[model samples]
Target: MLMNTPKSLPVKVCKIESDARNTAVWVKHIQNDFEIIWILEGTGLHTINGEQYSLSQNAVYVALPGDYHELLINPGAQGYIVRFDTSRPDQVDSDYHTINESWLYYYFSKTPVLRLDAGKHDKMKNLIMLMEQESAAYSSLHSEINSKCLQLFQLYLRQHIELLSNPSCTYKMNSLLKQYFWLVEKDFKTQKNVEYYARELNVSANYLNHMIKRASGYPASYHIRQRLFQEARKKAQYAGFSMKEIAYYLNFTDISHFSKFFKSMCGISFSEYKREELKRAV
Candidate 1:
């Protein structure tokens, strides 16, 4: 993924790419833009924000903006990658950084990996292929490609609800509460601090706390623990990584600290989490 400029991002409305094979995608650390990887064939591993996973054929992984992740693609693996900018509609200077970042991270984390039916997979693949062909043709109807891309996105949403049976919404924020909830999930690891978010929103930490608590019947810290637990589960999925490696990889202050954090969040040690996750994977 490249982040030369904000305009380079073709998200918010539409984005299209085709035949993405044999491309060594080592770029990470993006300030803006969201990304979605739809695999058509083959297998590869992706490290998102320091966690890693093995992506099989015909699967999808959605990445939110500001997340620093990279991919290790194998030969012959092809997919369409998309990045959406959250700040597009919401002006950057209109609000505080912490509040904006929290909401941004929240929606960004909503995109979960989905395995689609063969027919659905073929449909998306064909749409991507057509977009590629249009790019090669260089027709004057350039807007057509963009329009087709939007159509493809709609079809994707349709399949997302009908085929996959996932009820999660896409891109747009439904409410301010839902928005901030997701942002905390996406950025808890890097930031680890939530009060800064309240401050940035120009509100008291107690106000943010009371708002999240009253709305969700839980404190804002719940989202922090939720994200940390998710990361711990992910760490359990990868093998051959030592305890210390996992700790540092997860940005824990130290092994002891990570152990405490894991236990505090999950009621188990890292080793136990790994064992359980492996058994579940099997």
Candidate 2:
């Protein structure tokens, strides 16, 4: 059964199982803060974002924050479901699944699932069952058990990325677009205008903007200013350097100019932004 968590949930490590020829519970459109499902016995089907994935007894399913998913199983399916909240910035034991949209678009363009080989599946099963037993029986060494659980969790992710990466996929790159992203991704916060990047990339500013928007769905200027803003965000704090020094480092001619630019972009003075971030961190 999937549960709704309106907040990011901090889950330690735990596993639950539904056995075939034993129990029947259909998992429907529920959002989880963090979920990892591993197939143990039979086969089943899962739908995430309306994409259906076939799952055998060795498949691992991952539901990141705010993901909509539903589960349907045949008569002879068995598996384990572990739900936890770890990506939240604060508080454990709280689940933040309020929305029904996925944040994975920033990174993962496809569904997040991993199917393991039989040998790896057996190893995962052992770790999951052991965590269940230790958590079920309280002992003075609870932290030790938790550490082991996190280790197993890491092992799962390592295996997942290894199998998911297709070396052949790199050949599919749109060269000009790839270069555009790399240029902006490597230098977004310090430069905020399209014309400058256009000069460096040797394209006219108009052409650069068009290609950037076409490729990344964001304006080239947006990427540049974003990069500059990122640097401003970092330097507005702890850089005992005077505002003038910060301005010059960012290639601004004068402190007043930098201040205005920062204010225009961030709606606040650099000092104010730094103070706010510090307050939040504290």
Candidate 3:
């Protein structure tokens, strides 16, 4: 289940170290703020911006604004969800060298999940815990601590630049998937063809499909459809547009075509999915 919480703070920390209620089943949507999820224990799957990352102990997942992501955790999980606004200097210092001057955000934006060993994970968790305590006080010192802790976190990430950034096998496949995902996010609404993506990547459709499947365990077509479905689901649940208007906005030929695709991807009609979500919200 999903829970709605107040977003008044510059930095908010929710701990799941002892209780399951702290973790929420996040639905697919474009992120509106920065979120750092540090898993101290548990296993699950995290899908972010059309890529999937296996979740294990000490795995950290970062979600930036404009990225589509969903989190599914197995029962008995433990973690911390750290959310902070980028625009607020108190929460995240814009002048931080490790974050902006060193171009660490590029690496994070390209690949957001990082795997750490036990010792390093504990170090990162300590910072998160400090932020949590400071957030409770909401004093001037809290802002300073937030800046220092965030900068320290990014510095740590810069130290392990090559080791944990991609988490994939080869550099070549990682590069291909990154470009492919970027293109899909940019044009999934109007261009749903795998061949179009392949052409843009300067590879043949078959080779693109093969590499994507070998890396992500899903074909190029599946990723394309996943992106489309993500946007469709987000609109159906949150947008004010009618079904027909949504179809037109998504570049569907008509509502009929959109309805069929929605059913095939979602396993139910659009209205049915909305009703189920509404009941859960209540």
TM-score of each: 0.48, 0.47, 0.54
In angstroms, how far off is 147's CA in candidate 1?
7.1
**Cα lDDT for residue 178, model 1?**
50
Angstrom error at residue 44, model 1: 1.6
- Tens digits of per-residue lDDT, candidate 2, 14-40, equal 433444465444554445455677767
Model 1, 170-259: lDDT tens digits are: 223235565465466445676666686676556677887777776545677777777776666555556666677767766787789878
User: Model 3 lDDT vs. the true structure?
Assistant: 0.70
Candidate 2: residue 25 Cα off by (Å):
3.8
Q: Which TM-score value belongs to model 1?
A: 0.48
Give lDDT per model, in order. Answer: 0.57, 0.56, 0.70
Q: For residue 16, what is the lDDT in candidate 1? A: 21
RMSD to native, candidate 2: 14.7
Q: Which candidate leads the pack in TM-score?
A: 3
Model 1 — which ten-residue stretch has the worst lDDT?
Answer: 9-18
Model 1 regions lying over 4 Å from their true place: 1-9, 12-31, 90-112, 130-221, 224-282
